[model samples]
Target chain A: MTDLNNQPQQPQKEQPGDQPKKSELVEKIQQLGQSNVAQAPDSNIHVLPIIGQVEGHMQLPPQNKTTKYEHLIPQLVAIEQNPKIEGLIVLLNTVGGDVEAGLAISEMIASLSKPTASIVLGGGHSIGVPIAVSTNHSFITETATMTIHPIRMTGLVIGVPQTFEYMDKMQDRVVNFVTQHSNIDEDKFKELMFAKGNLTRDIGTNVVGQDAVDYGLIDAVGGVKEAMEKLNEEIDKRKPDEDEQVIQ
Target chain B: MVLYTPLSEVDIFPADQTAYDSTVITTYNQTPVKAFKLENGSYQIVQVLSTDPSIYLHPDYQPGMQFNA
Candidate 1:
């Protein structure tokens, strides 16, 4: 320590209270630099966008846009544990990349204790179907479409009878997850998964907004207005239960 | 430039107005009014308020039936 703080102790004035504002400015600037994703803590609602493709254990090439599983899992934990965060809004616009990675995200969203909602915009293709149905309520914009198809993988594969069985088991995991969380029937979901001729040379059905609702895959055909309103309502509904717990 | 519905009438400017040439209005009240920079001085509505949590297409438009898989 400097002997008796030999520095000049000239002016004695209350420290200005502007430090918080200065830090806030820095935070604002940092937020501005981020792309697509943002969080508005004031409303206690965090917005998470699953865009491009969901990247798995192997990181995708720099050219490919991906939502990494590792990043999102910890984020989901924060949203659940955060006292200020009252709800979650998942915005999905993915071509559906890695099956395991997408399923991990879906499981996290489905398990959140707070009010959760999802709105599929554009194309929530492939594994995105499971994610779209992971929330308590799901919305699909009129223009958005979700493709339901069996799971497929890239890279080398072993040519054994067990390989086919392993693939079938993986497909079942996805199917069960979707049907269990969503209102869609098992048969209906399977039908969509295996349907042919929908996509040129691909086997699956392209389900649009209202059709998604009709098939019980999504809860409503609406936009931000509806999704936010419904989520707010759910948050309000949860308040009393929290109070009841406090009383006990 | 078209400042879409309801938000067009809002006279209040967002704090981020100075950052971008264009104003991003959103339909969701909780979602902040985000702004984007434009090449020219005049700001356009790059983001619709309701579309802040959007993916795929912009809020106002939807892709055709032949969507990329």
Candidate 2:
């Protein structure tokens, strides 16, 4: 078996004109620890990572890692426009940032024609909750946690009462999005958001893997393997419709 | 100014804006990437910002790879 595998690679390496190519291949294997397999230029399943902080209007400092809306919005538009891209898998590991930005991303993902599956790996806190549930299906690892919290603002507050109402509206938007997208209801979600003892000195609940599923916040408890399986299944389900359209 | 996050505002926002000016977003092989300009005038990849899954598979496009042109 080993000899047969080696036989096909021998000629390509020994050809006089192929010397430069051979060295490049060797370097690639040495550096990446694997030979680069010939894959189609377009990918049917594209992964969009919602990692670090979801940056919005403010430009975060260079030291901080963030997922900028400008980059993601255009990429998402491209993914939707590209016929080759059939499925989207959103990988979430975000601490959450601006409310509007996070919601904008969630809305875009929710509106995509292609099937999507989101897997919350680490902590998908605050605004990430909406984005996580915005997909066709969502997953969370056994250790992953989702923090359900109310919207808050820091720094100076000129009108405390009006600010509270504005924050309430913002919080309602997130709640409405999550409740509409996922299996969780408004009452239960609000309960989780206002739960007192779950987080010390904080007014929200940090829901762990299975608990999130129990609360109907996430679809299931799983990682990449399960998320990919779900995505492939959804993609396959959509294939027939596309084929029917082609036939017509 | 209205940051909604579980993390402290101080930890999220830096006091100095000049520190962020060193990096720039440019295209490498038709893919958008965030890179830093080295002293030698070459760019080093900081992040591969492409939605194409195959782009990430390329060894040269990986983070920290010295991208020429």
Candidate 3:
């Protein structure tokens, strides 16, 4: 092998007076060809994972793994416009963050004309409540949990009754949206929000798995397999309506 | 050149979708297997690339020798 290394390498036939940089460009192209990410997007169902904390306008530290709303917004637009995509599956496993940003995402998903479904894994706490309910159908794993709590601000406030009123209005938006989207009623949900002993050191209820379904916050208690089947069934139902539109 | 690396370090699904269209997955036994999603949207192995010469040649191999030896 050492003798082979010592042997003078065979020279390649050069294409008439190519610059060294041009040969370097050729190498770069070859490297790009081997990457799986560079391939054209395919597949009918897109899985959008809402993992970690949902970062709003403020950038979280680099150490934090966040599903930035900006990244998701554009992808959601693409998913809406792209005719190739037939359905969407949102998988949520978030500690949840940023009220405004989370609300924005939930609104966009609720307004999408395409068939959509969501499955909550682990804990969908804080503002994640609205997002999980926004989908056409929702599922939560039997072990998954959801925290129903009032809105909170981290920064300085005027500390007045007016500030309290403003917080109350914002909290209403979240409560109203969740109730409207899911089977849960407004009064019952608020009852859960102010429930006692469910969470220590907090004033809210931490609804678990089947408890969530029983409360009608989530449509069912299931995992990925069940969620996919539900999404596909919804997609199939929408097909005839689309074909009818084309005929007219 | 052949690179011997663990599967965990390399991301098999770099794209956004849960199911890949047709990404060839190479196994521990040095078998290169191709998979495709079915009509029902489940994946099944479509081909085994055993006939093709491996792009990766084990560096420590010798004739009539066990891999562990």
Maximum-DockQ candidate: 2
TM-score for candidate 2? 0.82
In the range A1-248, model 1's lDDT, one tens digit per residue, is 01112433436444676576566456544543322233332346778889898888764443456777776787788778878778889999999988899999999999999999999999899989999899999999999999888887655578899999999999999999999998999999999888889888989899999999999999999988899999999988877676567885
Please name the candidate that would achieve the greatest lDDT relative to the true structure: 2
The predicted structure with the larger DockQ, 2 or 3, is 2
User: Which is the winner by TM-score between candidate 2 and candidate 3?
Assistant: 2
Candidate 2 lDDT score at position A229 = 92
Model 1 residue runs over 4 Å out of place are A1-41, A241-248, B1-69
TM-score, model 3 to reference: 0.64
- Give lDDT tens digits, candidate 1, residues B22-62: 33333222322233434553232333222223321322112
* lDDT by residue for model 2 (A1-248), tens: 01111222223345656777768778667644566644445468999999899998877777778989999999999889988888999999999888999999999999999999999999999989999999999999999998989987655577768888888899889989999999989999999999898899989999999999999999999998998899889888766676567875
Superior candidate under lDDT, 2 versus 3: 2
TM-score of each: 0.65, 0.82, 0.64
Please report how far candidate 1 places residue A21 from its true position, in Å: 17
Which residues of candidate 2, in runs, are more than 4 Å off? A1-42, A241-248, B1-13
Candidate 3 local lDDT, A45-160, one digit each (tens):
77677889998776554345677786678678877887767888888999888898999999989998988889999988888889999999999999999999877776457879
Identify the superior model by lDDT, candidate 1 or candidate 2.
2
TM-score for chain A of every candidate model? 0.81, 0.82, 0.80
